[model samples]
Target: MKKSLLIGATALALTLASPFSQAHRVWIKPSTTSVSGDSEWITFDVAVANGIFHPDHFAYPAERLSVVSPSGNPVDIQNQQKLRYRSVFDVELTESGTYKVFNASQSLVAFWKDEDGERHFWPGRGKTGTVEEFYQAVPQDADDLNVMETANRLETYVTLGAPTADNNKLTGKGLELKALTHPNDAYTGEPIDFQFFMSGDKAQGTKVIVVKDGEKYRDTAGGVEVTADKEGKISLQFDEPGMYWLEAEYEDDKAKAPAKKRRASYVLVFEVLPL
Candidate 1:
C-alpha cells in the first residue's frame, strides 16, 4: 500500500549526562525520529538512576498528557493502565496526516504509587509508560515535519480498514477483513456468515474463493465484478471451521508470455474460533 509516510524529527535539549538537582526534564525514547510500523511502540521511560523520593516532596506529580493537533488544538484523551506501565492517554490516528503528542506535568513532580507494589517519588510518575489511543485518523497520525534526503529506516504501512457494519470491506488493491464473523472456527457443523465486500478502480477481472481446512470447492465467490457498485463481496458459509482461507484470483498481470500465465490471487487468512 502506497500510503504517504510523512517523516518528522524532534530534538531535545536535556543532555543525558546532566545531573538533576530537582525534577529535571521529560524525555521520550527510541529517538530514532522514524518509528517502524511493527516495532513502533512509544515508551516514556523516566530517569530514576538516582534521586530517591524524600518525605518532604510536594503532592504526587501530575503527568498531564494529551495529543496536540497540528493546528494546536488539544484532542480528547483517555487513561490507560497496562501491565508494564500506566499511561495518561493514547492518540490513535486512522487517516494519514500530521499531529503531535504533547505531555507535561499535571503538577510539579512529587511522590506516587501504582498498582505495582513499588512506592515511587520525585519522577515516580515516570514509569507509567502505556498510552492508550485517543484520536484515530490515520495515515494522518503525522509528526509530519521534515524532508529527509535518504531515510534508511522505513515503516511498512498496512491498510487495515475498520470493518463496516456489514463486516467485510476490501482495500481495492488488497483484501481487508474487519467485520467478518466465524461461527465455526473448528469446522465441525453447519457453516456460518463470514461476510465482507471489496472493489477496485482498475477493471481487472478478479475471482475470490473460499477454501476449507483441506478441501477445495469450485463454487467460488460469484459476483465480484470490478464495476463501481458491483464490487467484490463475500457472504458465505463453510462446511466446518479450522482455518478457512479466502483466496482471490486474478489473471496474473506480471506473468510473462511463453511461460504459462499463472492466476494471481490474494489469500486473506481467516479463522473461526470455537465458541
Candidate 2:
C-alpha cells in the first residue's frame, strides 16, 4: 500500500473508540528465523496490536518495511499486502546469511498555543513532518511550544544458513540493538545478551521489556523487565520456546533546534528454540 493511504487508514483506526486503537505496540513476526537449504522463503506479519504478535488493532504500513541482505545490500520484498488487521510480506532468502527486516522512521512533532490560546500541532497529530518543515511553519513566539523528535524501529532477523554479522552492524543513528548473542542462535533457558544504543552511543540505564507471545490468553501478564547496565547491556532468558517481543526506549536532550527532546524506541521479535 502507498504511504499516504496507510497513514489515512491508521488515522481512521485511531478515531475509533476501541481501546485497541490506543497505545498499541508495533511488531513484525517471521515464520521462522533460521532456515537451511540453498534458498528459502520467509513470510512476515506486521501489526500494531494491544497484545504481542496479535493482529487485533490495525495493519502496520507495508511500505515502511525494508529488508537488508547479509551483504549489506537492499533486498526486495514480495507479495506485500495490507489485510484487515495486519500487513503480510514475503522475503526470498537466497543469501546464506542473516537478513534484517525492519521498519524504521524518524519525525519531528510539536504542539504550541497561539496568542489566542488555541492549541495547534505541527503537521497535525498522527502525521509525520520533517525538521525543516517544522521550523518553517511553527511560530517563533508560539506559547508553550513543546517540540520533540521521535525515532522508532521495529525489526526482526531471518538467517538462511549460517548467521552473519554484516546485517547486524549499527547504523549510528536512533535507537538500535547490538546482539552479543546472535538472535537466530538463541535457545531456550540460555542467557542471551543484547545492548541498546542511542544515536550510536551506549544507552545506559535504559529500560527493556520482554513479553512472550499469547499475552491475552494468560491470566497474568508474565512480562519481564530489565534495565540496561552502565554498559547498556542486558541478558535475557526464556523458559519456554516461542516467539518473544523485546522493546526499549530512551529519551535525551540531543534534538536540534525547535525540538528540545528526542525519543528513540526499538522493538524486536525473536524466536527461541528448545535446548
Candidate 3:
C-alpha cells in the first residue's frame, strides 16, 4: 500500500470511530533509543490515546496510530500496523528529516497463538521497533540567509527514541524478541502458514518452540528447526495463524573478540494480514 494511503488510513483510524476500525491508545515500549553519531534524522515513539488497535481486533493490538513529518507530509510505514504481527517499519530520524508522533489510541497489546501448537507475533510483549536514521540538514542562521539552498538540500535522519507527553513507555536495548511467527490467526484444522526471524547467537541448529494461547504443547517432533543463510536470515511458514510465543536460545563460542561475542537478542512481531 502507498505511504500516503497508509497515512490516511492511520489518520482515520485514530481520528474517527467506525465498525471496521478498532479503538487504540498510545504508549512507547522502549522509552529511548540511540544512534551512531551526527547524521540526518532520528526515529522514536509518540504516544497514542486509543485503547489497543490490533489488526485481528484483539491480539497484537496497537491503538489508533500514525506518523507525520514537519512538512505536513504524513509518513508511510511497513504497511503492516494493521497486521502488527507480521509487519515492521524503518522509522527515520536525522537532521535531513524530522520526527513528530501524532498519538496512540488505546491499551497495551498482548500476544496470541493458534491451535496448531505454534506461536505467532504477540503485541504488548515489549518488542523493539527499529528506528533507523541520521541528521540531514543544518539549521539556518540569521547571518547566512539562503532559502533556495536549504530547500534544495535533501533531508537526513539518524536513530534515536523520544517520549510523548502521555509517558506510556517501553525501552531497553538489543534484540527484544526471539525468532517466532504465528501459525494461524484464528484456528487451524489443516496446514497453517508460519514465518519468523531470529537474532540471538550462533548455535549448531536452533530450536523453535511455541506456546499456544496460554497452553503448553510441544511439537518437537519433526520439530520446527531453522538454519541461517549466508547473510544470517531465516524464515519459516505455517499453515495457519494462532497466538504463540516463538523463542530461540543459542550461544556463539567462536567469538574471541568482544565485538564477535553475542550479547543482544531480538524478536519480530508481525502477522499476515488479509491482502
Candidate 4:
C-alpha cells in the first residue's frame, strides 16, 4: 500500500510539472496598487521570464489567473491579451475593499544526465493547493529513479480599499511570500516586510533579490540582496516610487525522496507610491 501511494505521488508530481521547462520564472505586475472608487478596472501584466522577471525575456501565457475579492469570491479575468513579452489582462474592482490578483502554477521538472549517462528528474508538487499532503504521500526511502529538479513560482497583487485577510494567508505549499507591510499599501520610504514559508515552515536563509524598474539583471544598479532571517523574514525599503520586482529563492540539494533538490522561488511585483 505504501509503495503504491509513493508511485501515485510521483505520477502526480510529473503531471504538475509537465507544462514548461526548468528555466521559466513567473511574475505578475498590476497597473496600480490602490484605487479610489468602488468600481474601477485594473490591468495586470503576467509573464514568465528566464532572467528572473526581466522584461527582455520572452513570456509565457498567463494560465489559471483569477482575482479574489475581499469577501473571498474568485473573479475571472476578462479580455486577456498576450504580447511578445507578457500577457496582459484586466479585472473590474466591484468592491471597495482589497482585491488580490493571484497567479499560481504547477511545478516544473528538469532532468540532466548524470556522470553515468543516466537521466534523473526530480519530483514536483502543486503550487497553491495541498503540497505537504502530497509529499507525505510519498516515502523518503524511495529509489532515486529519474531524479530531476523541481521548482514552483507564484505572484500576487493587492488592491487596497476594503479590509481583507486574503493577502496574508499562507497556502503552506512551496515557497510563498506573506506580505507583512501590505503590498498594496506600500510607500516609497517605508520598509516592506515579507515572510517566506516553505512547505509549511519558515524558510530561513532564503536569498531575496529586488530589482527596480528597467533593470535587466538582478545584480545591476537598483538591485539589492536580502536574506531571510532565522524566522524567515526579509525587509525592503524602496528609495523612490516606481515598479519593483522582489524574488526569493531557496534550494535544498540534500532533500529526500519526492525531490532530489527542492529549488523553489516566490515573486511579488508591486508599485510604491511616492511619499
User: How many clashing residue pairs appear in each of the predictions shown?
Assistant: 31, 0, 109, 7
Error of 1 at 227 (Å): 14
Q: lDDT tens digits, residues 4-107, model 2? A: 77556545533221112246788899988999999999999998887887899787777788899999889998999999999899999998999999877667
Estimate every model's Cα lDDT from 0 to 1.
0.28, 0.83, 0.28, 0.67
Query: What's the CA RMSD of model 4 in angstroms?
Result: 7.3
Model 2 lDDT, residue 143, Cα: 92
For TM-score, candidate 1 versus 2, the one ahead is 2
Candidate ordering by lDDT (highest first): 2, 4, 3, 1
Model 3 residue 35 distance off true place after TM-score fit, in angstroms = 31
Q: What digit string (tens of lDDT, one per residue) describes model 3 on residues 125-228?
A: 22221111101121222222211100000011122332121111122221222223221122344323322222322233333333322122333322345544
Q: Which 10-residue span in candidate 2 carries the lowest summed lDDT?
A: 13-22
Instruction: Summarize candidate 1's per-residue lDDT along 1-275 as a digit string, tens digits.
Output: 23222110001111111112223222211111222242233232222121111112122111433444334455454333322221223344342222333232111122234455433322121221111211121111223211111000001111112211221223443222323342212234444433222223332344544444333233442322221113334455444434443434333334222212222223333443344
What is the overall TM-score of model 2 with all chains considered together? 0.88
Q: What is the TM-score of each candidate against the true structure?
A: 0.25, 0.88, 0.25, 0.74
Best by lDDT: 2
Off by over 4 Å in 4: 1-25, 50-54, 106-110, 114-151, 160-163, 216-219, 253-258
